[model samples]
Target: MEGFRLWPGALDAEAQSQLVQAVFGALGTAPLYRPQTPGGRPFSVQMSNLGPLGWVSDRGGYRYQPTHPVTGQAWPAIPQMLLDLWAATVGGKRAPDACLVNLYRDGAKMGLHQDRDEADLTAPVLSISLGDAAQFRIADGEGRTRTLRLTSGDVCALTGSARLARHGIDRVLEGSSRLIPGGGRLNLTLRIAR
Candidate 1:
């Protein structure tokens, strides 16, 4: 965790509840959809977004778009709590233009991958974990990996040398928390996607 920073319990119970509500509100407009890998394999996690740009993937490839792929409407604005979290944790004048909201239920695991689609690689990717705990794995280009338990309300940032590091969620510990109504994990990653 040399280049990564983790803040345990970054949001209290009430704050987490409010943030969950904001996510649901955004979902109403841009519903979550399962994305397929470039090779046509479906991803386990369903995804949506808030902010001007949203991260999406399909058989075409992974990229960012101004509008939701399903609805073809512009994505809702990033929640105020998320914007404030970015401003406080990342501490820069420029705010993140993309917020990728990933919903992972039981058995949903993201393969290790690097986040290099953004124009500015220097900007940190701030990830907010809600609901259940996930076994988050991070590694360098050499493939040395470390796994950490990311619980509800925890926040982590990948910045500087770790910005493009290989990372993914191995698995979510089911029934870890009741923060999510239907039982799942929600990961919100704020990024500068310009």
Candidate 2:
């Protein structure tokens, strides 16, 4: 956790609710879709985006694009709340041009991987959690790993030495929070695609 900053309960109940609503609005424009790895295996979590660029994966590979794969339309603008959060937390640095919205439900979980698709590796990745809590695992290249309980409204940033660290959600604690209408977890990751 040396290079990571965790702000537990960064958003209050009302703020969380508003953010969720904003997510719903974004979803309306670019619906969430299950992404496939370069190997053609589907990811457990479904994803969408809110920004000029969106992170996506398929048989082609993992990269960022300017439009939705399904609708072929540009992603909705990043939510103001998210922009404010990034400014207050990771500001004084380059602003993010992409916001990857990941939805996890039931047994959905992500595997350990590094976020290296961005052009600017030095920029921090700001992640915000909503709905259920998740067991987030982070590890260095040496394989030293640690798990953190990321509850609803938790905000965390991976910067400095941890910017390229391997990280993923081990599992979501179901029914941990009712912030999400259908019982699931939402993770918003802000990054600089270019």
TM-score of 1: 0.98
Per-residue CA lDDT of model 1 for 1-194, tens digit only, reads 56699999999999999999999988999999998899999899999999999999988888999999898999999988999999889878799999999999968989999999999899899999999999999997688999999999999999988988999999999999999979999999999999
Worst 10-residue lDDT window, candidate 2 = 88-97
lDDT of 2 by residue, 32-63 (tens): 99989999999999999999999999999989
lDDT per model vs. reference: 0.93, 0.93
Give per-residue lDDT, candidate 2, residue 90. 79
In model 2, residue pairs whose N, Cα or C atoms come closer than 3 Å (at least 3 residues apart or on different chains), thus clashing, are: none
Q: Tell me, what's the RMSD of every candidate?
A: 0.8, 0.8
lDDT for residue 194 in candidate 2, whole number 0-100: 94
Give each model's clash number.
0, 0
Model 2: number of backbone collisions: 0
